[model samples]
Target chain A: MSSEGTQPLGRARPQETPAVAAPLLRRGMGNLATVAAHLVLMTWTVFVAFPFLWMVVTSFKTDQEIFFSPWRLPSALRWENFARAWTDASIGRYFLNSLIVVTGAMVLTLLCASMTAYALARFDFPGNRILYYCFLAGLMFPVFLALVPLFFVVRDLHLVGTFQGLIIVYTAYSLPFSIFFLHGFFRSLPGEVAEAAIVDGASPYRVFFDVMLPMAQPGLVAVGIFNFLGQWNQFILPLILMPNPDRYVLSQGLAFLAIQRGYESDWSALFAGLTITMLPTLIVYVFFQRRVQQGLTVGALKG
Target chain B: MHHHKYRLIIPFVLPSALIYGVFVLWPYAQALYFSLTRWRGFSRNRPFVGLDNFERMLDDRLFWNALEHNALMLVVLPSATVALSLLFSALIAQGGRGLRGAEIYRIVSFFPQVMSAVVIGVLWSFVFHPNIGVLNGFLRVIGLGSLQRTWLGDPQWVLWAIALVAVWSSVGFFMILFIAGMQSIPTDLYDAATVDGASRWRAFFGITLPLLRDHLQVAFVFMGLSALDLFALVQVMAENGGPSRAADVIARYMYDLAFNKSQFGYATAIGVVLLILSLVLSVLVVQLTQRERIEF
Candidate 1:
């Protein structure tokens, strides 16, 4: 920008009325430019959204219809593909596995992170500074680099291929960001209410649970949505740790279905499986769309 | 009384400390030791051979090939995604009042951000399918059939094709980020520029981009790290790292060595290399993109 031969912001004139001022990108008005921008945006909209739409549409078509008329609407709305994918393949089971692990991990991650964050934020104690920074450092380390030793650690603890193993590992991996974000939330709280509760003969735990916990809910929800997406969409960890066929998460199960699709050629069922995997995230994102984006962007900027 | 304070603090801090210690910290520490040993994963015959794996990796063709692919991605993904995202953000959120259909476009574009990488990889794999695939089918319909290729299967275009998908899925997320960054800048900065006869393009260069430099730097680091460790997408999209290892990356190759080939020691060496490269590259990115701070 400095090299672009333009007036710098310091040289910017005082604000003028909208009618007097030519707003950024609004001057030299051309219907052609606006139309061109809309055209390009629409093209990208299709590029991004069409794949998911086609996944849903193709799921309703029969194999012949899919192969011959890829763009045509399904000749019939055969719900059989959904049923077959759900029952015959393992999508249904994997969906439940993902649900269990992700929910379990989220609860634990929030619990440990909140308690730890509260202590680090509100107290002046020895080793607190060192411990907080230690937790924060986890955000930088690449998880896959630890894959080999991580597998061995899980195996030694007899948690090599179990749900509990995944729940704990996911929680541990989630702690750094959770603690970091929640520390800010906990620190920003007014101390008077917590002190008043403490003076009224409440223990620290009681004070935290009754007063402080409720106050930290917004931060919890933000980090909760953030961790939920990370855990649900997790792949490489489960690939190594949860090798048992029955315990496959949705991502793994979808990948398994895709590889098998090449042999079985049940393209419709594969589409159905992918569409099924997409549904829960779509619903969650739509519901908590604002919080999710805010949390993710904040995480990147802060971390 | 002094001990009583620790009584409360210890309980709160211990659980996180324990969980983080065993799972995240311990394994990372052990990886250093494991990288120097030669063993097949199961037994305890891990006799140490210091730096042998590193020596082997230095000479290994596959390691070099994979590193080259990662380097290529490191360059391509960030630049393409950033350039497209910056333009889209400006157009969509122009002067604090967007163009028509801006809301729908903003919401719809962010949809892919929520979908799992495996779903994206699987879905796009079909989109690039050669025969009845959407891409080839569209090409034929548009009378550009000669331009169609078996995108994933073709070695010449496999890496770029997959890179295109990465850019496709990620541009929206970064665009949203840029829009957020844009909103934080004082509106009068743009207004002032506009009132001074600066053209729209000139105002963007002088104001919007300079103010958005911080977000831009972070995005570059995030993208570069992703390029370094694109294991999940490549695993789901390409079979065995594509034809002749054209799409192979360091992380995927490391997975093959450890799990598939039983070369745990060698794989750990590659993983160590990956860890070092990521650390170095992120530092390099921040350093290269550094400019004189323009505090508003």
Candidate 2:
């Protein structure tokens, strides 16, 4: 207990702290509870890992192998499954579409949201509190609440079924959270830099853009990660706003392919398509997981 | 400074404010009005029918069916997710320092949460694919062939199946949350409890659980709201609520009405109902979970 946070991570190098290890193991249910904890942990690891491993293995199997040898690895790496998924199943198109929409939306969200957040944080205008809370209010209800009319609004703007339409919609909905998170961040930033820049006769916009925005880089990154993942994985907005089959985002495209699995049972290609849809998110999570957890946990605890 | 404030403020705020208003806020206000009318597709003529959609919900069988499922979710999803996460978190931080690789477990378990819900749904459909599914295949190998059933296709199992996936995808996120909470509780409290002859069970339920109430509140509200808005999963697993409408939920009912059926007014009404349910759920969690703060 005394060496609490100093527990060396990774493999138990109990040799480094033999004194610490012995009493810790001996104190609780002695060896039994540790064994039970390991059992629970192992069972969960298997549960989470099994489906993914199975999916990865199954993606390479031929239709025949998929049905007969469900447990077996594919006899060969059937790269055609990935090829068919990418080309024929239109997963490649969907992946590109998701990239465009998410990239555009994330940039727009950070730009507009950070500007708005900086205003709320740095200035004390007449309706500052009102505007701040107004933005935060979007966090309370689920985004789907506006779905029925949101379509009509998009259609009215003649932006329906386009990347710009979906991008703006994603940016709009993401505002509440981006603003909320960045507002806290911008508010907490040291005011000395901004004050110093202003006193040098720097224009207010100059102070914000050249001075303040760069200072808010850490906040921007956190918000960027949260919104990038959110906007990328967004399903309903794209499902509703971008109704054209050719322009469907990844999640919506996968659903289309899944449902279409009935008419054409290309099980391998379907699995490959699902894996394709999951790849970028997997890569992002693998690298930026610590940041992802921190940013999102703050959102969860607050929102 | 005061004279120049509005220059930065108005420009900084107005564009996003305008976009947010038109796209998000305006639609929210417009939905309430649309709900009270008989607004339909591509129509120039529309009659304002006060309370008609809401009243129709009283007699709508599908409405009740969907509401019942969501009500069931309101009860089931949060409890299952919270219980598993709490247990996992407690284990991760047990006695201040948990077993080796607890941190790694926390890290890997979170992968599913970051995956798009559509991917999870489509992936699990393969897993529940009856003959080719791993679930059934494992059952056969384990000599439990008779126990296998078409999970998503079974009316009795469909809702629970989706809920189970929902819990599985989410439990890790909450585990990380609770682990943070547990690790923050001073080790001295546990030491004090042990010295007072409190068993681990008593110490956990009494000291650990009580101290983690705020985290519990966050977990419940989030889990409850998600349960209420289980639109993505339900749409993926059972677009029209699955077999015999066994798995229909309010959010899906709303989406189906608006998108497929094009009964925009009635669908918007349903959306309003979903909104009200979520608000009530949040308020209820706050009221119910409120406790006196114990300063350490």
Candidate 3:
């Protein structure tokens, strides 16, 4: 929710009065428009949702049935396809590894981003503008630009092929956008609240934790969900950093199911693997859809 | 209070500053330094190659080709995607209220956003497969047989093919931003136009276009950066930017130089060039799109 008493809040909600007493010709035209809209929406929706639906359906069909009738729904639902995908492909282990990597990255990114955002927002220190611009520049710098040197840096620190290494890279990758989003939210907070707390003999730490942090909760949730989704679905960094089979995250592991040799092109198994991999992100999105959308739009438009 | 404020800023800022410095700032500085030296990665002694790497980059045909492809993408992908998304947003906006269909469209369009680029790349590869592929299959049924071509395998069409998929994947997300921007434009303007006997097209050009300028600029910047940094689809669709390096963006080029070729110094030079290009473009975009603050 936006801050209360900021503007005439009625602007947030569109009026919903139903139109009545339209002429017959106008009504007919309106009905035709509505039908056209639905037709267009449905056609595009099917196009968009087809791969996801196909992935689900293919995951259930037998391998023989996959190639024979790739488009047809399975005659019998085979839940065992998922079981095989989970066990034979070591997806379960990959899930845990991904969980570890995402969790570590999210925790560290949030902690650091929040502290950084709070400082930049609330304090008028020297070099504040310079510091803010530095973070903004990070947003524009493509991560690929850093890959060659980062590989050497990670190697020098002896962190390659480790969960810690992936976390560090992910955290560093995510910090710029995270800090950017949090900084906007913190800036929007009225300074009076923090000032009042400081005047009440509260230290900056106490004021940040006890006052500003609570106010910045929605922003934090937004940034956290964005980072979590990003880290969870990440393929590139894991592909390069975690070359060991044991260290593969879910995204890489699931992709391996589709690409690995010696395995028959089991469409069902690949679909099952993809479905399992996509579940966590889907759940997060469903729960915090609004915040995620807001975060994305704000991050883009504001930056 | 002032003294306490300085103390608070110190503790609050220190931790993040340290982490960011170590992981980001330091590594970036090192990347710049490495760009000037020929380090064989594992070798302890890195020869200071000076501008040799930069000079080589000037002559590297692949680098220029990749830059051309990136420029083409910057022109083609963002404009097409954003324009299409804006059109869709305007259509949906005009469809009036009680429209659950709009919600469905939003969800379906954004589904691709949730899927990883790798998965999308793999899935679309099958869709565009020449023989058993869906697109060709449809073309055959429609009697447009000659239009069927090997989308990814071809050197010429690979970039366009990949760009089409990228647009398809991203249009929904941008549409959402456009819709939000549309909503922010007060409906009274539309009402006023209607009362003045304005056509839908007239209202759109007069009211919608002007108000949506800020959102459009933002979408442009985001899509431009994303297009410039394209790698996942390039990696999956063509495996190595296809034959003759057709779909190679700067990111994939950087990856190949570092990981595939072990050309550390050359790769860093390429990376530095990309960084500079992105920075310059981003600044230009910001300057062009900067909106005067509106006091309501």
| Model 1 Cα lDDT, one tens digit per residue, B31-118 | 9999999988578899999999999988899999999999999999999999999988777666333355676677788778877788
CAPRI class of candidate 2 = medium
TM-score of each: 0.94, 0.94, 0.88
Give the TM-score comparing model 1 with the true structure, all chains together: 0.94
Off by over 4 Å in 2: A1-26, B1-3, B95-98, B291-296
Scoring the B chain of model 3 against the true B chain gives a TM-score of 0.89
- Candidate 3 segments whose C-alpha is farther than 4 A from its true place: A1-29, A190-204, A261-264, B1-7, B98-100, B129-150, B154-157, B283-296
| lDDT per model vs. reference | 0.84, 0.83, 0.75
Off by over 4 Å in 1: A1-22, A25-29, B95-98, B292-296
Per-residue alpha-carbon lDDT of candidate 2 for residues A191-270, written as tens digits (9 for 90 to 100)? 99988997899998999899989989988998898998898888888888887999998899999989987568899999
lDDT of 1 at A208: 89
Best prediction by lDDT: 1
Top-DockQ candidate index = 1
Q: Candidate 2 on B165-205: residue-level lDDT in tens?
A: 99999988988777666655666676677668877788788
